[model samples]
Target: MSAAREMLCDTARAVFAEAAEAGMAPVEAAGFDLLLVPEADGGFGGDWGDANAVLRIAGVAVPDLPVAERILSGLGDAPKTLHAAATVGLMAGAMGQALALSIEHVNTRQQFGRPLGKFQAVQQSLAVLACEVAAVDAAAAAMAARLDAAGLDAEAADFEIAAAKLRANRAVGIVTAVAHQVHGAIGFTREYDLHRVTIPLMRWRGLHGNDAYWAERLGRQVAGFGGRGLWETLTARAE
Candidate 1:
C-alpha cells in the first residue's frame, strides 16, 4: 500500500471504531460522504482506491451500516455497478474476518485431547477458508484499480465489477461454511461474533448483484466483445 493509502485506512479504522459504539452518527459527523468528492469542490478529491480501502474497514467494523450507500451518496448519482464495486471491498473484509475467526477457533478449540488445528480435516478446511479470502481480496483490489483507471465510471468498470462481485458471491458460501464448520456449533450462536460478518456477507452477495445475475450479465458482455475483441479490450484495459 502507498503511504497515503495506509494513512487513509488508519483514519477509516479509527472512525469506524467510534461508529461501533455510537452508530452511524459518528460516521456522518466525520463526513465520509465527502470522501469521493473533488478537492476543488472542497472535498477529499479521493478515488475508488480510497473508497475501497475505507469500505474494507467499514465492512470489518460496521458490517451492518450503510457505509457503502453513504460513500456513494457523495457522487449524487452513480451507476448501479458502483454498488457492486463497493460490495467487493466489503465482502473482502468480511471474508477476511471470517477466516481470522476460523483460524483462532481451530487453534483454540480442543478435540480428542488436541487443538482442532492439529487435525488434518480442520487444517484442510482452514486452508480453503484462507484461499477464498485471498481470492476475494484480489478481486476487490483489481476492481478498485480498474474503477480508478476508469475515473470511477461504473459503466466503464462494469465488467470488473461484475466479475469481482460474482467471485465474492460464490466464495461466500465456501468461506462461511468452512468458518462455521471449523467453529462448530459455537459459531452459530447469536452471542458469537462470527455471525456479525457472516450474516452480512450472505446479505451482501444478493445485494448489488447475485451470482446468476452477474454471470448472465458478464456472459452477455463477453458475447458482445467476441473472442478476439475480448482479448484486445482486456489487454488494453490492463494498460
Candidate 2:
C-alpha cells in the first residue's frame, strides 16, 4: 500500500474503533464517503483499491456505518446498497476482526492450567480460521483491482466480482463458525464485541448476492462459454 493509503486506513480504523467502543450509531466518518469520488466531482479521486481499504477497515471496526456502500456508490445518484465489491470488502473486514479477537482470546483464556492457544485443537481451529480470513481478504482485493482495471468491461468485472463475492460468502460461514467456536459461549453474548462483527458478516453475505446466487451466475457464465472457449474466456483481459 502507498503511504497515503496506509494513513487513510489508519485514520479510518481509529475513528471506527472509537465509535464501536462508544456504542454509537454507525454514522459516516468524516471524508470517508469521498474516497471513491472523482476529483472532478470534488471528491478524493480514489480507485476501487482505496475504497477496498476503507471497507476492510470498517469491517474490522464493526461500526454500523455504510462505509462500504458509500465508497462503492461514490455517493452518486445510484442506489446506496447491494454493491458487490463493497459487500465483499465488508465481509473481509469482519473476518479480519473476528480472527484478531479469536487469537487474543485463545492466547489469554485458559484451560487445563494453560492458555487455550496452547492446546493443539484450539491452535488448529484458529489456523483454519486465519486461512479463511486471509483468503477472503485476498479475493476482495483482487475483485477491487479487477473493477478498477476493467472499468466499463462488464463481462470481465462481473466474472471477478461474482467469484469474489462467492469466496467471501463461503469464508464468512467458516470464519463466523470458528470464531464463535473458539470464543465458546461468550461469543454469543451481547456484551462481547465479537457479535458485532459476526452478525454484520451474516447480514452482508445475504446482501448484494448470496453464495447460491453468485454460484449459479458463475456456473451459467462458464457453461455458456462452452468447453473450447472457456479457457480463453477466463484468461482474456478486459478490452
Candidate 3:
C-alpha cells in the first residue's frame, strides 16, 4: 500500500479499536460530516475516497455498524437500492456466518465420538473461510485506495464498488451454506446465532443491488465506455 493509504488504514484501525473496546455507538452522520467538510469548514477537506477509507476501516474493526450508508451518500442519489448495495455488509455478514458455523461445528457433530471439526474436510472449509474474510479485508482496502487516488472516474468507481459488494454478496451465500452444511441440521435452528448472520446476509444481499443487479450495472458501464472519456481526463490532469 502507498504511504497515504497505509496511514488512513492505520488511523481507521485505531479509531475502530477504541470504539470496540469502549462499546461505543457508531456516530454515522458525525463521522461522515467530519470527513466530508472542507478544510475551511474545519473539515478534513477530504472527499469520497477518504470517507470510503474510514468506512472500510470501520468495517474491519466493527462490521455490525451501517458504515455502508455513509459511503453510499458520496455517490449521491443513484438509487436507494443501489446505495444499499454499496456496503461491505455482505462481507461482514459472511465473516459472522463463518465464525458462527466454526463455533457450532467444533461443539457438535461426531467422528469417532469427536467433533466433526477434527476431520480434514472441516478443517479445509475453515481454512477457506479464513481466506474469504481476508479477501474482503483486502478488497475493501484496495477500493479505498483507488477512491483516494482520484485515478478512478466517478462512474467507474461506483461500478467497482458495486463489483466488490457483488462479490461479497455471493461469498456470503457460499460461506453461509458451507457453514450450515458443516453444522448440519442444528445450524438451521433459530436458537443458534448462525441465523443472526445468515438473516442479515439475506437482507444485505438484496439491499443495494443483489448479485444480478450489480452484474448488470457493471456490464452496462463497461459497454458504455468507448475509450477516451474519464480515463483520459484522469490521465491528462497533473498529479
TM-scores for all candidates: the values are: 0.96, 0.87, 0.62
User: Tens-digit lDDT track for model 2 on 97-176?
Assistant: 89999999999998889999999999999999999988887777767777788652445577778888889988888899
Candidate 3: residue pairs that collide = 81-208, 84-208, 85-208
Report the Cα lDDT for residue 225, model 2. 83
- How does model 3 score by TM-score? 0.62
**Deviation in Å, model 1, residue 70 alpha carbon:** 0.9
By TM-score, the candidates rank as: 1, 2, 3
User: How many clashes show up per model?
Assistant: 0, 0, 3
Count clashing pairs, candidate 3. 3
- Candidate 1 structure quality by residue, lDDT tens digits, 218-239: 9999999999999998898778
Work out how many backbone clashes candidate 1 has: 0
For candidate 2, the clash count comes to 0
**Deviation in Å, model 1, residue 5 alpha carbon:** 1.7
What is the per-residue lDDT of model 3 for residues 34-57, given as tens digits with 9 covering 90 to 100?
554567866656655555556545
| Winner of 2 and 3 under TM-score | 2
Please, what is the whole-model Cα lDDT of each candidate in the order they appear? Answer: 0.90, 0.78, 0.60
Cα misplacement distance, residue 131 of candidate 2 (Å): 1.9
Best candidate (score: TM-score): 1
Most lDDT-accurate candidate: 1
lDDT for model 1, please: 0.90
